[model samples]
Target: MYRLVVLAAAVALATAEVILTLHDCGSHDSIINSVRVEQCDSEPCIVHKGQDYTVHVNFTATRTVQEAHNVLHGGLGFISAPFPLQPENACQGSVTCPIVAGQTYEYVQTMTCPTFAPSITVTAKWEVKDENKQDIFCFNTRLQIKS
Candidate 1:
């Protein structure tokens, strides 16, 4: 009875954090369990200008990672530009390097709301890659920047 209660609670928590309708990079990417942005809980996550926000990505390691790197970009309509991936070293936060295969991990990254950015909607692409430049996972999500 205790185990069942714990399991149900886990299921509920997972569902609470899940960002459905994940946008995938391609066939090479791993399936992301969920993505969460700081403060916002629903679609078109709103971020305030000049404030910092963190994004959490939950996924299982598809392969052993000796080292991991971050790739990030922002898109608006047909135009896309690279966004600086803070720390760039994917292993620095939440989960560290030399990640073992078949294990679950949460990857965390933080970005500052661009003060000069127009109050507009954009999709951000976030990717984690292995040492050889192969993707562990890549996904895009909508965000709204506000003043």
Candidate 2:
């Protein structure tokens, strides 16, 4: 009976650990190997209003991109203005440009939660484009916030 109880506890802990980790929201292109919200290590990653968080992305570029940018949209019409990816520096933007084909890259960015933000769920979309305004890679994730 003691062993049974220990096993049950272990199982519960494991399940809880999994629940605390961020979950991928949708399928992405092969180029985008993985997208992780560092701040949201657990499911429904929670963010405090007026705090800062980070997102980590792993991907491979299939073709060279001269100009790149990213756009993030959240619930209740919250939209992050388009920004450059700085592909030459390893695609370090919501949009990364000038990425060389056949190379793997890891990108990380820290963002601030606005003070005016309300409690809600948010979906962040990231993309990389070329100078011609064509998509190279795209990925997204979901998160929660509290005031």
Candidate 3:
């Protein structure tokens, strides 16, 4: 269905675009409150004292509901790398239909960071919404990668 596609696309975009800076959305602090590092291959990944290396970071986002709904199906995604989300598709700030209540959406993304510092943190953020831009839920997470 077209609605499903839009919802999927929104989530995909948030996942793909990794260049987003780690600044909270203006006046939307509550939208991205909790960010935890669920799992990681390694913590404080150590790199050579002065050498640089590449490490991959993975994270998740669990947003809260903004409005009462029977369900909240499709949600958007976010990334901290320079990668682009759904580069082939052309949708920005788009919306899909509302989902029933008590439903949670999950998304995953991978990014490359320099093992330059002792460690680096990556965070993801996104929202669940409907076709009219009504926000249902939002989420964010942080991953600590050591060098």
Off by over 4 Å in 1: 1-20, 27-29
| Top candidate by TM-score | 1
Instruction: Summarize candidate 2's per-residue lDDT along 18-131 as a digit string, tens digits.
Output: 222323343232266666665554766777887776666676767766655554445435555343333433345543445678787775666677777668777655554455
> Model 3, poorest ten-residue lDDT window?
87-96
lDDT of 1 by residue, 38-86 (tens): 5665687877899887788888876787888888877998898787767
What TM-score does candidate 3 reach?
0.26
Q: Rank the candidates by lDDT, best first.
A: 1, 2, 3
Listed in order, each prediction's TM-score against the native is 0.79, 0.63, 0.26
- Which regions of candidate 2 are displaced past 4 Å? 1-30, 76-97
lDDT of 1 at 85: 67
lDDT, candidate 1, at 14? 57
What 10-residue stretch in candidate 1 is worst by lDDT?
Answer: 12-21
lDDT of candidate 1 at residue 125, scale 0 to 100 = 82
- For model 1, name the residue pairs that clash: none
**Which candidate do you rate higher for lDDT, 1 or 3?**
1
